[model samples]
Target: MTDLSARDIERANFAFSVYDFDGSGTVDAIYLGDLLRALNLNPTLAIVEKMGGTKKKNEKKLKIEDFLPIYSQVKKEKEVGSYEDFLECLKLYDKAEDGKMLSAELSHTLLSLGERLTDEECESILKECLDPEDEDGFVPYAPFLKRLIAGPPEEKPAEAK
Candidate 1:
């Protein structure tokens, strides 16, 4: 596999801790589903069934090396959450007073907001926002935008004084 970033490594370690709920140094299928649900992700239906799937019933525990698939699913759901939040923020960029976030306006707003994207990058984002189904200059930020930027950062509580 490719090298994992520091942040990704941190996330993986934390996920391992969360999965190893019993302090048993390993995670079984039961713990795996629990971990997924705790993070607001639905567990794999096969695991939810617990006694199904092609794999032998005795081979239920998964090693850290086997965590890549679960971690990938977690990342996907986390990104979906970010995209949902970003769409809500896009409401602030409605310049035409018609509630539509136009491609030109979105491109300008993103740049003005210190997105630091190149012209080509911005155009690429605009293209993703506007597909064949959309009319020229008509882009639905709510329906799309997630295709451009991943979801928002995970929120943390403020430290008490």
Candidate 2:
């Protein structure tokens, strides 16, 4: 936790709301895959194999702990931390003001991380994350961020702007 700031911890906690697959308040295997792939990691079958088969082959959830490895890697490579650093990283993935990102947003976010995704893959990702309402198809940011960092289910997280 030495590398993590209070804000970084908060950001990671907020990220868990959507990333947590089992609603267990703990990230598991599937969640790791999603976050890794979303961040543009190769996400090979071997990685899935390491999960003790608790996760399906194609599942997309992850244990929050799994993220520590990647975070460590990123920190080593890019020296990651700082409230501004966390904000910039999150902003790359958050497309709309509401702070929630569907699959498309995630794909674009990965792109910003230097990954390339096909249009078909992007479409598939959107299909996965989108709420299926809003003909214009925009994800709301505030509630999305709230889901990540909202205090005690009744309070708002501090506004990012």
Those runs of model 1 whose alpha carbons end farther than 4 Å from true positions after fitting are: 1-81, 95-99, 132-136, 149-161
List the lowest-lDDT window of 10 residues for candidate 1.
49-58
lDDT, each prediction: 0.58, 0.50
Clashing pairs in 1: 82-151, 82-152, 83-151
TM-score of every candidate relative to the true structure: 0.36, 0.33
What is the C-alpha local distance difference test score of candidate 1? 0.58
Q: Write the per-residue lDDT of candidate 1 for residues 1-161, one digit (tens) a residue.
A: 52556676566667777777678666665556555555445444454444222233335776666665555545454333355566667787766655466667777876675435678877766665544334757566665665544323468999999
Q: What's model 1's TM-score?
A: 0.36
Which residues of candidate 2, in runs, are more than 4 Å off? Answer: 36-62, 78-161
- lDDT agreement of model 2 with the native: 0.50
Error of 2 at 19 (Å): 1.5
lDDT, model 2, position 133: 41
